[model samples]
Target: MLSKRLVSCLDVRDGKLAKSVRFVDTKDIGDPIEKARTYYEEGLDELVFYDITASSEGRDILIDVVERVASQIFIPFSVGGGIRSVEDATRLRLAGAEKVNVNTAAVQNPDLITACADAIGSQSTVLSMDVRRAEPCDAVPSGFEIVIHGGRTPMQLDAIEWAKRGEALGAGELVVNSIDADGTKEGYDVELTRRIAEAVGIPVIASGGAGRPEHLYEVLTEGRADAALVASMLHYGEYTVGELKQYLDARGVKMRMRF
Candidate 1:
């Protein structure tokens, strides 16, 4: 089996690393470049940097920060937020991001996904979905809705349908982030993750609500996620990436162990 990836997320707002609960009450955490280097040194498989407020603030991603963080980490680095065009994606690539993630822009114009994939390879195009559990309805039969603009707006689109559509539109990977579970430290929404993972053929990265290593294990196995995106746990010094990897490796989850 392919080794499951452990990705540390740096949610930055105005260049300072931040953390939020269910997409609200965000507070600055630490220096993003310092944290990125720390995680990379701890053997993190990947790192994702999101300019969390860029889209909502009607601005472009902080390319200077992306470049700075990219210079510190050698792992696969993915950047998102406020990327609106193929040129934006290409700019991030030139700034040193291995993958460019599109969330709000992709939801607004899905063709942007195909366009980015065409400009950069599909393998480097990531579709990030900020989702929240909702009442089951005809429009959202899957009971999950897509929220955009840093979770400030609900798009009324079905999460499962969007995942499948994103794959068809040339998204090589999916980051399914559950707004309901974000920063709770409870655990991932395995059911929601499993639904999207099974609905699409592309790799799924389960994001939000990871409190411990066991949570990662459950999401990787029961959730059928190809990777787990962690924020609070790593951002607050609750656990290091190597410790999480060691825990998962001991539980028989395939991991790229450094020691």
Candidate 2:
């Protein structure tokens, strides 16, 4: 079996690291470059930087911040938020990001997915979905709806269906973020993660609501996720990436113990 990955996410707003609950009440945490270097040194497998307000503010991603963070971290780094076109993806790549994460823009124009995959390899294109739980209906049979614009707008699209469609559009990976579970620190929405993972052939990264190492293990195994995206736990100094990796490794979840 392939080793499971532990990815630390830095939600950047105005070049400062921030954290939010259910996509609201966001507070500045620290400098993005400092936090990025800290996680990378703590044995994090991957790093994801999201400009939280970029989409809602109608602006481009902070390329200067991306470049600085990229220079500090040697691990695979992915950037997202406000990425609108192939040109934007190219800019991020030139700024030193290994992959470009497309969220709101991809939902608005899915062809952007294929365009990025064509320009860069599919492996360098990541599809990020902000999803929330809703009542089961004809449109959202799975009861999970896709939300966009930093969770301000809700789309009629179903989360599971969107995941499959994203894969067909050449998104090499999927980041299934549960808005309902984000920053809750209770645990991941394993059911939500599993549903999307089962519906798509591409690797799914289970994001949101990770409180402990056990939560990581559950999402990676029971949720059938290839990786787990952690924010609150790591951002607040609740746990270090090295500690989580050791805990998961001891419990039989294969991890890259590079440290």
Candidate 3:
């Protein structure tokens, strides 16, 4: 088994680090560069800088802000939002991102994955799936459905099946986020993550609902995830990557402490 990883997420909007609950009601938390510097200094494994609304609003991710954050952080950075073509991936990489994450565009054209993989190598492409549960029933649906545009528009496709399709389409890694669980800090949607991990051969990154250090350990140990993506909990000064890594190492989760 791979040692679990702890990644810090930076969701930026209007040039500042921001976070929202269920992808709505966003509030700027702090200057993005400053926040990113804090996490980088705290020894985060990797950093994900999401231009939260770029895809939905139809514009390129803010490279100026990206450049600002990338200038200060030394960890591998994954930048997403409004990346629709292989060219888009190339430009972001040249802008100092290690990987490009695509969601809405890939769902619209699954071939984008193959194109992107061919252009930049699959390792440089991270397929970020935005998912949400369907209406309540007797039991939770065995499959989650893709929710795009920050979970506002629902895609009529099974999330689990889409994950398998993404793997076949040449995505090197996957980050599965629960719209229902994002920023709630209750914990990750572990069951949802487990199913996706079981469905794909690549690493699965569990995102959203991470509130405490234990939540990190639980998702890796119980949910069987390869890595975790955390935002609000870390953004709000609730805990640092170093703090979580130390806690996990002490608890036998086997993550290397960065600092």
Candidate 2 structure, TM-score to reference: 0.95
Q: Which residue segments of model 2 deviate by more than 4 Å?
A: 55-61
Model 3 clash pairs?
A: 144-159
Instruction: Mark the 10 consecutive residues where model 2 has the least summed lDDT.
Output: 52-61
RMSD of each: 1.9, 1.8, 2.7
Q: 30, model 1: CA deviation in Å? A: 1.2
Residue 137 local lDDT, model 1: 91
lDDT tens digits by residue: candidate 3, 94-123:
778888898999999999999999988899
Better-scoring candidate (TM-score), 2 or 3: 2
Q: How would you encode candidate 1's per-residue C-alpha lDDT over 1-259 as one tens digit per residue?
A: 5899999889888888988888888899888899888888889899998877644342344788888877777788998878899998999899999999999989999999999999999999999999998998998998999999888898889999999999999999999999988888899999999999999999999999999889999999999999999998888888888889999999999999963
Model 2 per-residue lDDT tens digits across residues 162-238: 99999999999999999988888899999999999999999999999999889999999899999999988888888
TM-score of each: 0.95, 0.95, 0.92
- Model 3 TM-score, 2 decimals: 0.92
